[model samples]
Target chain A: MEIFGIPAQALYGQLALGLVNGAFYALLSLGLAIIFGLLNLINFAHGAQYMLGAYVAWMLLSYLGIGFWGALVVAPLVVAVLGMALERGLLRYLRDVDQIYGLLLTFGVALILEGLVAQSYGWSGMPYANPLPGSVDLGFMRMPMYRLVAIAISLVVCLAVWIAIERTKLGAYLRAASEDADMVQAFGVNIPRLIMLTYGFGVGLAGLAGVVAAPVYQVSPAMGSNLIIVVFAVVVIGGMGSIAGSVIAGFGLGLIEGLTKVFYPAASTTVIFFIMILILIFRPSGLFGSTR
Target chain B: MTADTAMLSVRDLHAWYGESHVLHGMTLHVGRGEVVTLLGRNGAGKSTTMRAIMGLMKKRSGSITYEERETITLPPHRIARMGIAYCPEHRGIFSRLDVQENLELPPVIGADPLTLDRVQAMFPRLVERRHSPGTKLSGGEQQMLAIARILRTGARFLLLDEPTEGLAPIIVKQLGEIIASLRTIGFTILLVEQNFRFASGFADRHYVVEHGRVVDEIAAGDLAAGSERIRAYLGV
Candidate 1:
């Protein structure tokens, strides 16, 4: 049967693909929101860190005979340590400066990381054989098992993160620190150490997204650079530092884009940007964002 | 006056906010378990003394030795961990954090911490406002919350900057009684008070600050005799 002049199979297929894409956007933007919120730094190296995640995973599998499961555990840890080093060695020095300097530093880091990887791996791409090769048949469409796993995992992680930041004691410190870090410092909390750990955690989230994307998307340097813009658009529309907003907007926008593709294929690519522009006009802080 | 029993000693403590010098050799001391007051007007460097002692000022110099340990060069967190808690002039109640969260956010650092239950009991008004956002509280409630938050840190010394400002008379009385109780239990407090009469009722001594230094000193016993002199300093 056809739904709105399109076969159910094709329509459901596009929706599933969009959700898988949304999975990555949700993870990446969630990290962006976190780093931006606590550190007060716009981490432009987020895309490079995402690429590093995929590269670390690829190296694990190709060089050490580690599988996807092993890479899943190891990649984020490695990247988190690297992220902590970056914060300690570089970013912390610029903490008291204006936000623009932090943004530019991260931008430089992203360029250097991407450049090094491209020089080594070649700019074209590297293919990663899908680990979960089988597909499950639904009433409307047959969905790949890996894509389903990815969607489910991303949603669960996004929820877990939201809880961690909103419901826990450590979360209270984080929220309070974002509001008045100087007060938190005077209250006996080691703010500099906390900032470093938070930056690592956010970078680790991006790394986790990259590892998850390797088997489905091309395991290449440009892979993250190609997708970061869309993920940023999702962050902007959702609200720059709102965790729930970013998560919801990530998946919500993906599904909306999916619907647009089915209806007007020409506007699918530009639809999120159009919505972002509209949000900027009416609510410059973005939907769900407060003045904070 | 003597460093022998002083829990906090400031010798020629000076600090700067960028190029503008704020604290100019501000010298003071709070004896163990003594309630001392820094009495001054708006631009008299009272708050800057608190900040400098707590290591919050970026350009603080001269000697600040707390518990006989030199803290002039220590970072704010280090000074805080050394058992000195600073409740800022503005109260610093985060709008985003609920009352309970704000109370619980400051980590309990040292021994003999005031349990949350004890704090809640002390400030009975906070019990009902536990779930409300911190800024949702009334002025008196926010001040009580800030004081309560620092108590949980187990700090033996407290730096309270203008806690009675913008507060009701009843709240001020309650805070005065709490300070009396704190002193009885061996807690040293260095308070900055714009309300001279309220502080005179509780302080063991008063340090009269002007510009950025302590220009005069008055013992609690001699307050009545120096009442006119103190009033002149306060410009009241």
Candidate 2:
């Protein structure tokens, strides 16, 4: 069978790859949305955190003789602790300042982190040994087992986070805190602790995404920087801090990008940005964002 | 009165909002089991006084003694934990949460908090709309939910900021009755009200605030004789 002058096999292969990419996008953008929602700050270091997760995983394997499974559990925890420290030591001080300063500060942090990693490991990509080193025939294409696992894991994580924020009592506090921190504090909730934990959780999600991506993409300093721009675009298209919106947009855009690759390989890279522009033109607040 | 006999006492309370001084040496006291109203016009520092007492004002310096403990330098949460509940002018209801969830939000600060059934009995309207979000409720319902939510915290002292604002006459009457009933059950209230007529009927005493300081205090029985002075002070 053939569609758009491309063989079905090629289309399916691209779709599978697109889904894998989408899973990462969902995870990263979900973190971005959470951080933005609670902290009201754009974490430019998200990409760096993602890179740190991958590098941490790689370091665990090479230096500590830990396997991929162990890195999967430990690397994110290490990065999350780093993220919490960064939040407490740095980001909390910038709370009352202008939003632009926060962006610049995080951008500077990203540059420093990336610089430090590049100096030690160099820019060349280092491959992590794939734990799931096989492929499965999924009727249309031979999907890599690791990619499939990544997709499943990412979906579960995204869904779990979404439920925690939207449906639970703790989530109600988070949503309320995002709106009015003073009011939440007045309710006798230790709001500063909540904000710190929320920032850590969001960054932890980014770290987890990095761990997942290390097997598929090379563990390199540029990996996070390379992927973060696309995730940002995904966030914007999905509506800045909308939880479900980010997840849906991430997966949908990934699929669209995949289909575009199969149809016109030249436009695949720029497709998400083009869609973002279009969405901005029509709905200035993004798709799911309230005009506040 | 000393802090020993008073439920809440603010002495020489001074507060600022980032270089702009709002409250300058303001002082007031609420006796145990008393229903007191801080009556003043807009921008007369009535709200600022409440904020200062609640520790919501960042640049506030005052000796706020509650239950004989000086709460001047305590954080808002700490002050809240010390059995003082503040319901701001905006109602401060979390719009994302349902009425039941909103009511359940505040932590219990005292040993004997108002049970859910007791609260529901006080405000039956809340029970009818327990599943509805805070923003979806009517103005009267939101006000009830706000007052009722704090009741669960077991707070003996309530700092209510203009609870009757923007409500219908009947709703205001109902709220006033609820406030009156609350006093009978032993909740010490410090109400900030603009409606002098409504407050005069309900409050045990009225403190006339002007430019961040209390210029006059009138007992409930003397309100009729002090009406002229209060009207001139309030400029209502």
Tens digit of lDDT per residue, candidate 1, span A24-96? 8999999999888889888889999999999999999999989888998899889999999999999999988
- lDDT tens readout by residue for model 2, B126-194: 888999988899988899999999998888989999999999999999988989988999999999999
True contacts kept of 1: 0.94
Interface RMSD of each: 0.8, 1.3
Model 1: pairs clashing at backbone N, Cα or C within 3 Å: none
Chain A of candidate 1 gets a TM-score of: 0.97
Model 1, range B1-236, lDDT digits (tens) per residue? Answer: 79777889999988999899998898888898899999988999999999888888989889999889999988899999999998999999999789988888888888989888888899888888899999999999999999998998899999999999998899899988988888887889999998988988888999999999999999999988878888998889
lDDT of 2 by residue, A92-171 (tens): 99998898988998899999999999999999989998999999998767888999999999999999999999788889
Candidate 2 — which residues are off by over 4 angstroms?
A: B1-4
Pairs in clash, predicted candidate 2: none
lDDT of 1 at B232: 94
DockQ of each: 0.88, 0.69
C-alpha RMSD between model 2 and the true structure = 1.4
True-vs-predicted CA distance for residue A167, candidate 2, Å: 2.4
Least accurate 10 contiguous residues by lDDT in model 1 chain A:
A283-292
